[model samples]
Target chain A: MSVMIDTGNYIAAKAAVMARPAVVPAYPITPQTTLVEGIANYVKTGEFKGEYICVESEHSAMAACIGASATGVRTFTGTSSHGLLLMHEMLHWAALARLPIVMCNINRVVGPGWNIWTDENDSISQRDTGWIQFYCSSNQEIFDTVIQSFKLAEHEKVQLPVMISYNAFILSHTSMPVYVPDQKDVDNFIPKRIPKWKLDVDNPITFGNIILPAAYEKVRKDMQDSQEYAKKLIPEISKEWKKQFGRHHGDLLELYKCEDAGYILLSMGAIGAESKVSIDNLRKEGIKIGLARVRCFRPFPREEVLKLGKQADLIVIDRNISVGMEGAVFTEVKAALYNNSDAKAYGFIAGLGGKDVTFGDIEKMCKKVVNGKAKQLEWFGFEGV
Target chain B: MLSKDLVEIVFHGRGGQGSVTAANLFVAAALKDGNKGVQAFPFFGAERRGAPVRAFARISGDEIHLRSEIYTPDIVIVLDESIMDMVDVLKGLKKNGRILINTTKNPKDFDFSKKYDVATVDATSIALKHEILVGGIPVVNTPILGAVPKIFDRVTLKSIQDTVKDKWKGEQGNKNVKATQDAYDGVEVDF
Candidate 1:
């Protein structure tokens, strides 16, 4: 492995090129532009011997990926915020088509106010598109997850698209040191994609016609089954990656000192990583609290959340709010433990619209939850009614 | 305030002045000097030419987990001395934190130098001397980086020159390396 000091976007770009995807089609968006630029550089340098399509829009970008993946070629792309929103229709199409297209979606604030910063709503809103999702905290995690997502997506048991999301400016723009394994190591770890089925002119097959409810329900069930299979396969691939590369950013949920703690705080993306600092500080103050940094959001890690609930009460620091209900993660974790564990879960709506959520702010939230002073949910940094 | 183990720095400059590049190169040099955890990021907003822009950098012996913006910096580097009047570059700086500026004036000329450690380097002159110009405007980022190792020892003048070469190549790279060395020898520190 060689140490690379660069931004998350560039690291991810290197990881994607090293993975050796056959086709990379993308459009530029803030925070994600540099990533694509990095790939273009590799292409220019002849390091990446593949097709790089400069599509006009994100919609066309995904369309290009789907078209390329339909022919049984490995495909990759990236988008964020409005760019991701523009590709919404094709996102479902790619997942439903069962095309194993790996995408790195830089999580950014969905704009009504023309703002550009780190936020989760962009990818969080795409949660139900039948794609396996992974949230990363650091530049290394971003690189590793991008490489691993390709392996997971192309697996036979789990032929589903994977969306790897991370906080935009926090991860995309921030330069950090990441150890990039040799191309031989990466190529050995994940071989080129070999789809079980694909379009062949000689083989002549019709695809994606309208189906009746029975067949449609089976297709949906197949997607769900594939997702369930991904949960099991993600850890397996992660383990093999660690065995070869000597690093593991956890499987579904990265537990931080939660074994014997009475309180477990949960968060995802950059906030999840930041929570570790708060956990360390609180532990020094003699608080029996730990952290569960959710790495894989879908395949939900419901079982792990339930297990943590049985071990300790959960405090979720969600970076995305569902507007009316609460944080999407907060609701999901609460649902995971429904009628199972009596351990209550509290939700703190923090970092929405890219508001700063510092370690000190996290400490305050943890103290509120641990002291039994928190209600079911509250907006952090905002006075409640 | 930053922990003793971590070094947080803020870069202040106008757009096209390479504030973000300075932060990135600073951390890259630190990484080459064997620092494990280093991060550099621009202000999370749109950057326009001639607009005041800020970038942040951090150095730690261990992996950095805190992802928040640098609010309390241990060092502040100003790439454009003219920006110091428009922006509060010293905001949230730790007491006695080192402040480096790209200016022709002496370090003691800055009144705040009496209160905090201050360093000055005529980086614009160094950049011009090395013919490091983009659009006929001198690019002070690399030269200013050479002044950094004087105030912060975690990175070195050698690594700074090496990183500059890594980012650029051939004649252009040699010029940046020389500009960096010139600033290294030219910097004046007052503590």
Candidate 2:
């Protein structure tokens, strides 16, 4: 009668994908290993009935998934920092071909010095890769997002790949209580594969062929059109998910107590939860502060952000850096709020290589809001060099 | 709301101290008791040794909804005392939360007695006494778990014993079963 509770993101991910009966193709990568490993264990123990392919590398993993998804079956795979980079070429093709593949990416910092901890560099770097990316802050979001990813990616107007990421080591290894919906409810929420297009042997349609300049522009334009059309479908799917699951996070931009607040703490991934705590503590102290959590990053959610920016001062806290270009997220946030003349936004870079973000750091940031002095681009919890 | 009483327990340690293995063993104990739970580790992208790593276990009677990271851990188990200076392991620990430290040192060595009920055990010595190699299976978590009833009045040693027997099947299972008992027997209190 009630929902089943579970934890450990890997098990939730495995149970979700298996319940959907996906044809999974995965390879082992640190952090991202649990999802594929759990699925393998399920198939090995005869608990789940799905074709779990053990590939050699991240590249082959996505390639196998692309092939499987084109065959008209729901497909799944997972990867991390460099693993995602390795799949970069295939990711573009997967999106261009309009295959609805759902992937779980355990957000890890891409390395130049061989450091492997939690960071948003991997998923953030692929921000413009034509896929619908959703950053989940919790284990439950990781589970629910994967389930919603299928519907969003397979929608008639949006046959694109989707990735749901949570910070590596933070949410990946953090064991918190999570609610898993029943198989019957999930099946009802997402009916058996209603793909927009499939590799129909009888229908005989061509795919991924060479295009000359004359027709190449049209193909590219169509891809752009599909993505633009997806902006509307995202909220539509979120509405459906709420109708079935009773929780709605469908906004391109979700604001927290920003109605009366003068300053807004904007962050993606898991830090948003930490920001909420900071905001709550500050609010109790009689300071009006809020948080805007970005759920859909791919379509940029530019319109939703502009609409929300009408009320408050924005602070963008990014876990990834852009080297000489301010912060990666700061640049994007500024661009999103560029047209809004009434808003002033600040940027912060923090949490690289799995560095822990404590409540103290968040409280300190809130103090800046209380003081009414905000920087253009700053690093949280970092001191003098 | 009749929500499930889900408990989040975290283990902080160096790479080789058996924190992860201990967490898994605890899950096995819980699962053997017919309770559903998840055992997992935070594998830092780099697999090198002696890095400060963490493992987690979530045990509950009902489905959990707050799927966020365990910011406020109900129980904090320290396998290696050296990690205290690197990160704030006690940051969001609940007031009067149980702190299980695997050490020969007294609880006076650490500050903040008001926030925690510190339980010390010479688990490394116990593991060595039982001939569990430092590089081998982490046998300290179970023995430290023996002190659970003392720290928290909810879980019982009998529940843990039944859990170990259910998880570790057969004769080899019996050694671990004895190991659980020996671990409970080995709890050393440091005031």
TM-score of each: 0.98, 0.81
CA lDDT, candidate 2, residue A144: 69
lDDT (C-alpha) at residue A322 in model 2: 68
Off by over 4 Å in 2: A1-9, A19-22, A212-215, A248-250, A382-385, B1-17, B21-138, B154-191
lDDT of 2 by residue, B1-191 (tens): 11246677888877776676667656545544545544344434443468887777666664332333467778888887778879678878877677878777766666765557787777766666655554565456555666655654445677777665655577645655565566566554433
Model 2: residue A78 alpha-carbon error in angstroms: 0.8
Model 1 Cα shift for residue B91 (angstroms): 1.2
Interface RMSDs of the predictions, in order, are 2.0, 6.5
Docking class of 2: incorrect
> Residue B59 in candidate 2 has what lDDT?
63
Q: Count the clashes in each prediction.
A: 0, 3
- Chain B TM (all candidates): 0.97, 0.77
Where does the lowest 10-residue lDDT sum fall in candidate 2 chain B?
B60-69
> RMSD (Cα, Å) of candidate 2?
5.1
